[model samples]
Target: MTYRRAAIPALIGGLLLAALLWWAGSSADALRLPGSVGTLGPDAVAELQRWVAPWAYDPPSFLDAGVQGHGYVLLGDDGRDRYNGIYTAGLQIRYGAVFAAFVLGALLLIRRLPPVRGRTTAAFLALWAWGAAAGTLAAAVSAPWFIAAAGHGSHRFLPQLASVTAAGRQLPVAVSLVAAGATVLVARIAAEGASTPPRTEVPARAARLAATAGTAVIALSVVVLSYQPVAAALQAYSPDGGLLAEPGDLLRQWLLLGAWDAPAAGAVVDWLLHRASDVLLLAVVWWALSRLPGLLTRVTLPAMAAGAVGATVLGLLASQLLRIAVVQTGPQQGLLYSSAAIGNGIPAALTCGLLAGVVATAVLRLSLRGAPEPAA
Candidate 1:
């Protein structure tokens, strides 16, 4: 089968699987997981209620269920819904779209590979297992983002999430993982027996050198662009805000814009806009990186993924240094927010990197198929 013929079908099937996964994940209350902070008590529960009361009508169900119940609480919480009628569908769509992006990434990688002759059932099972494994890691690493989003206004959101959700976080994660795996399986079936086109060749040495340099550039760009948010979040936590006064209190602040005092509608809009911008920027960076010599080679998908993740980690380290610089410049900068934002953004970098690599490689190979090689 031609690449185009297979890709379109594969993408369609993959998206259907992604939608199914999102639906299942969003419908259940106990699917989302919190970190391993042990448990909670009455005081902890009350604190959680106060922080989440602005947006969530039922703080207990919302926090206890983690991401799973966020939609229901905001939209389906009867008249107690406290979202001020500004954010219901948008919130739900944004959350589910994240999981769908995971599915799309898996499909991109699978489509790049040559099809194999195997029973459809067996292919589905194998692909599903692999996808589930990936989903589990994504869910685990992204716990901080979800936890913070739920209870960002509160200083104790993380612990409260862990306490309220108890052990229920595992179930939603498992179900979402299972759904994620299905997306992979469907993509594989759709692309069965497909063949790849000839690709443009570059000198191996040149390719390696170029990829290395490109990766470094990507890392630096992330650090520089991210400094503003990091600085803003830190400044928001200063004495000027009357939020915290001691360096010891910095870790308690959620790494988000100080939207606690903003109107619920405005806060939700700002947060979503920030999220969309980050994703768009990362995608653009990855797309450009994938086009660098040899980075998107068929056999190098794993390397591309690893490189993307490594760059994100390196950028996070640089951001920490930047934060330290700001602290050294002023005695009253306080401890500010933790490096949670960078840590939370890793999964996005990984998936987007893979998807970009696959797409760039495909486009280049297809475009150059019948062109004459440059005379060397």
Candidate 2:
């Protein structure tokens, strides 16, 4: 492999990760927002709020959504000071370790899968595994960090102690149902792929294409992640402030995309649109890798190139699901779950997914080399 081979991925992942941590760690409140204008403001609240929304869960009991969202945030002045501690060093290491684990774990899962069909079959399993693994990594890293950073990394203090409101309780069943629906969908997909056979090598052409694609993933992820600081500044300085504040309303303001804007309702729309953008981006990565064809000798490269697009979609969607599902409240902020919103989680998902997709394709390419040829 060329010296550029190693440098490409390492540089991308490293730089992207650094910028995100810097932004989140810079100000405690930046990671988490106190709240909106509320009918009433807590004298103890870090920032005054004329309005407040309940957490995802119904409140009345302190542990519910209402309190967690506002309690710590409204915890007066000393609360803010205590929230600003620097266990960030430890959290940084934790995030890195989990991400590395996901990448390596995915490769290991591929090595262990039974047998499968053509370039696409092997590629699909690999894509799914890589995506699930990447998402799992982000969840593992961020979830714990969120839980800990609020309370000296302890079990009893952080999210548990803060109080909440009762709005979330209006339909507790509905909230659980949404969460359950998402989990079931994710689990069903994972289980289906888990039953797939082990694949040992990808086709020669597929392998080459995957390598180039993987290289591209590293490059693309780096560029996008690096620009996060710019995105953050934009969201921060804006009037409504933050992407989710009124995404439908905010999106209308983004007439910058020319003809590509069609936003929907609610916070979930943000998820749907963000993932859609991610898929679009993955398509671009697909285009980038596809353009390198003909120079590489592998006949199978074309199919694998197409598969790269699928891999990109899977890589990103999986991460988005996890980052969103996991409870990610912060000290000064309500929920710092997404990187695009707060930490580098969104970028992490995008890049990590891309990396996994390329790796999966690469692995499929390796397997294709040894498998019997498909019918002409």
Task: Count residue pairs with overlapping backbones in model 1.
Answer: 2
The lDDT of each candidate is: 0.38, 0.35
Kindly list the per-residue Cα lDDT of model 2 for residues 295-322, writing each as its tens digit: 2223343333333433443433443445
Error of 1 at 28 (Å): 5.3
Error of 2 at 232 (Å): 38
Q: Candidate 1's residue-wise lDDT over 124-145, tens digit each?
A: 3323433333333434443444
Best by TM-score: 1
Quick one: best lDDT, which candidate? Answer: 1
**Model 2: residues >4 Å from true position, as ranges?**
1-4, 24-90, 98-136, 142-376
Query: What TM-score, computed on C-alpha atoms, does each candidate reach?
Result: 0.38, 0.28
* Candidate 1 lDDT for residue 335: 27
Q: How accurate is candidate 1 locally (lDDT)?
A: 0.38
